[model samples]
Target: MATANTAPNPAQDTLALVGRILIAYLFIPAGIGKLMGFGGTVGYITSAGLPMPEVAAAIAIIVELGLGIALLLGFKTRWTAIVMAIFTVATALFFHKYWSAPEAMKMMQQINFNKNIAIAGGLLALAAFGPGRFSIDKR
Candidate 1:
């Protein structure tokens, strides 16, 4: 029988570190922007037909900042990534329903929807694979 290599790979570790950092970069600023524009975020959410827009906006800020920071530090990596994956998908569904967009906005909405899905896929990968040697999770 052939045995699979069950060893640490430096390249894989480095790549995981880079991926985590990049994802964090994407989210942290978004959280900060939402925090700074709380009223706008609430207005946007209301426009999307969601109830309690203020509450939704608050939850989004918390999740984005909390999970984004945790992912940046590689803390509770697996669960954090999983939660992020869920959050990404939910936002994509609620906020970027490109199929319903008016023609002119369809293309942009479609692109945003696809990007959110792709990010969720990446988060799922992080959940499947540990945060790697460079992470606080490793310590």
Candidate 2:
């Protein structure tokens, strides 16, 4: 019987690299925008009625920017993905609450909510798989 080879494959590594880049790319810009507009971020969070809007904004910046950069570098891939997954899901529940949105905006909110959830699912998958050979985790 032939055994399945488990050695790392270049194609898989490239794909993983691409995945990391795509996901983290979304975060980096978002973080930068939030950081650049700190007051606006805090205001938005406050409007969501979350406690400690300032603190929440800071955490968002850290998670999106710091964790994002870590993911891009493939550093602590599993932990990073797990954290990002949690963050993404929480964002959907808190910020993308379609049920609470004005009727005119409900559809957009629903779409954003779904998108966040899907991104979280992807993050969870990344957590389970670990970063590929190309990551700083180095497989």
lDDT (tens digit, per residue) of candidate 2 on 42-111: 9999998999999999999999999999999999999999999999999999989899899999999999
Compared to the true structure, candidate 1 yields what TM-score? Answer: 0.94
Which sections of candidate 1 miss by over 4 Å? 1-5
TM-score for every candidate vs. truth?
0.94, 0.94
Give the alpha-carbon lDDT of every model.
Answer: 0.92, 0.92
Q: In angstroms, what RMSD does candidate 2 have relative to the true structure?
A: 2.5
Q: Stretches of candidate 2 above 4 Å error?
A: 1-5
Whole-model lDDT, model 1? 0.92
Model 1 Cα lDDT, one tens digit per residue, 15-121: 88999999999999999999999999999999999999999999899879889999988999999999999999999999999999999999999999999999999
Q: Which candidate leads the pack in lDDT?
A: 1
